[model samples]
Target: MTWMVTGGAGYIGSHVVRAFGQVGIPAVVLDDLSSGHREFVPEEVPFVQGSILDTDLVTAALREHGVTGVVHLAGFKYAGVSVQRPLHTYEQNVTGTAHLLEAMQSAGVTRMVFSSSAAVYGTPDVDLVTEDTATAPESPYGESKLIGEWLLRDQARATELHHTSLRYFNVVGSGTPELADTSPHNLFPLVLDALAEGRTPRINGDDYATPDGTCVRDYVHVADLATSHVAAARALSEGRELQRVYNLGSGDGVSVREIMTAMAQGTGIAFEPEVAPRRPGDPDRIVASGEAAARDLDWVMRHTLTEMVTSAWQARQAR
Candidate 1:
């Protein structure tokens, strides 16, 4: 089966593309090069330069390639920026997804693996979030993703398209030898950039309710997350029931300070973080339980925090 990976040139998307290719799964990539790098996609795969928002381009590609499954990973994903530009975020994350869904339906593509986010759950009062938790997104980016899942739900009810929306939390780490993070907004890359310049990485807050007085989050390796997509596709192909949503995470919370310490240790870089006040809409803690994914998708996280930092640092150095 030929799989079409949207945003296949991005950090996590590129890893998914590589993962599918490594397994000898016939895959093609469609990216607009907005946040994705063309060089990230392998030369072996058929790469199409286009946006999911473009219905004509998307439909044509799906039909031409006879794509049976889609792994949707293209979207705007910055919490802070989403607050500043709600319309732009919604247009890219929601409208873009709607367009992709329509194109899929038109082209008779029946299965999909959407790249959802844990931000959809917002700041849950509970520490370990499950798929059953209430979704109360605090940022527009999160809200947009929530809407993306809603689109899938509505579409599945109306058609034969089966989708698995995997809500991801803090997707990090590297997969390929060239694992440079092109997104300038992510925490890992931001911290790495600061350290590379011998500058202090600024911590938004260090007086939260969590240990070390910092907010905590679950950081998962990109490769492991990509593997979950493959499993999701397999389960969908096995005639698995209707639309499903699962949380893919490490099942452990790591504080901001802890991550910084780990990075310093991993890269042998001694740099302090400049603590600042908490940013707006910032959650004190967000960690996901991968029980649903583990049980349903048979997923497991293989990398530790040290491994995440070390791999990311090495990737940054190579770039």
Candidate 2:
């Protein structure tokens, strides 16, 4: 059966698309290539150059592919940047979601795995977050994603659709060499770029209450994340009771200093970072418990933090 992968040309989206292809599940990619690179998509995947907000284009693609399901991944995802452009964020994340759902229903696609985020939990009072955690998203980006979940629920109530919104935290690492994040947002790749240019990677804050006095967050490999997408798709295809939401994470927190040290060890480079003021809306800690996903989807993340960082560095060196 063919599936439609919105944003199938971006870093995480491209990985998910490749996973589907590797499993012999045919996929059609709809990407505007705004932030997504054309080179990231696999050559054999059918590519549609368009936006999800384009209702007619999306509907046509869905019908053309005979889409059995969708894995929604397209959105503007920079938390800090969302604060600068809240309206743009909402239009892309929320309005675009509504457009996609309408198109999906029109095309007879009934299942999807949404790429939600742990950011929806905002700064949870507890250090570790679960699916049941209260959501009080501080940034428009997080709020938009939470609203997307609401949109999903609303659609399910009115249609035959079932969805699994996977709330993940700090997606990192690289599996395919060609699919590495060439963008400059993520921590690991940004640091690698700085060190490669003989500049120091900046540390945002050093006085947090964590073990190393830096903000802590969970990091999961992109490959493991892609694996969960396949699992979610299979579960829905089998007509199993769909899990409305699941957290995909390592359930362990890694600190900024710890990550820097890991990078130093992995790349054989030692340099002090320039300590700077914390970026606005930066959470002190965020670690998600993936127990529910493991129980329901039988998912396991085999990549270690060191391995994730080293693999990213390898991809960086290749670039």
Candidate 3:
């Protein structure tokens, strides 16, 4: 069965598309290329250029590609920018998800795998976040993602929809050097870009409650994340019941300072990161246990931190 990947031209989405191909699954890509690079999507894949907000376009693409399932990854993904542009965030994420669901129903696509965010947890009081953790989204982007999950749940309850949402933070690394994270907002790209430009990488915040006085975040390899997406799709296609939500995160987290150290070591760039004010809506630490995902999907940390940095650096230099 052919699976359609929304935002497949994006860094993470491109890897997901390739993962599907690795398993011999026919895949189609739907992307607006607003932030995604057309080159990120392979030449062999069917590429549909459009926004998910366009219900007609999405429906047409789904039908044209004979798509039986979708790995939905399209949305306004910048959490910091979403704080400033809440309306735009809601329009693209909340409204856009609604439109996508409508299109899926119209095209008779019953399976969906939503790529969600750990931001839905906001600043959890606990050390480790789980599926049972309370969702208290602080930013508009996070709120929109939570709403997207809700939309899936409500639709599944009312229709023949079978879906699951995978929440993750800081997806880094590369399946191939050709596919790189081009986002200016993500930490990896920001640091890599600064170093590539021969400038000092800036740490957004210091003096946090953490031991290193820097924001701590959970990070996973992009390829590993993509593998779980495929696993989720396979489970859904096989009519296997899956949890409503799963956190694809490492139980242990690394501080920004620690990440900078790793970057220096991995890239062989010895320079201290400049201290900068924290971005709005950023939490001090966000780590989660991926036990559920590991139990259901074939989730695992296949790459070490060094590997993550070197792969990202290689890809960044390629771009």
TM-score of each: 0.97, 0.98, 0.98
On lDDT, the leading prediction is: 3
- Model 1 Cα lDDT, one tens digit per residue, 287-313: 888987887776898887888888999
Ordered from best to worst lDDT, the candidate numbers read 3, 2, 1
lDDT of 2 by residue, 49-126 (tens): 999999999999999878899999999988888989999999999999999999999999999889899889888999
lDDT (C-alpha) at residue 311 in model 3 = 97
| lDDT against true structure, model 3 | 0.94
Q: For candidate 3, what is the TM-score? A: 0.98
Q: How far is candidate 3 from the true structure (C-alpha RMSD, Å)?
A: 1.0
For model 2, the stretches where C-alpha displacement exceeds 4 angstroms are: none
**Model 1 bad stretches (over 4 Å):** none
Error of 2 at 19 (Å): 1.0
lDDT by residue (1-319, candidate 3, tens digit) is 9999999999889999999999999999999999898998889999999999999999998999899999999989998889889999999999999999999999999999998999999889998999999999989999999999999999999999999999999999998999988887888998999888899998888988899899888999999999999999999999999999999999999999999999999999999989989876667788999999999999999999999999999999987
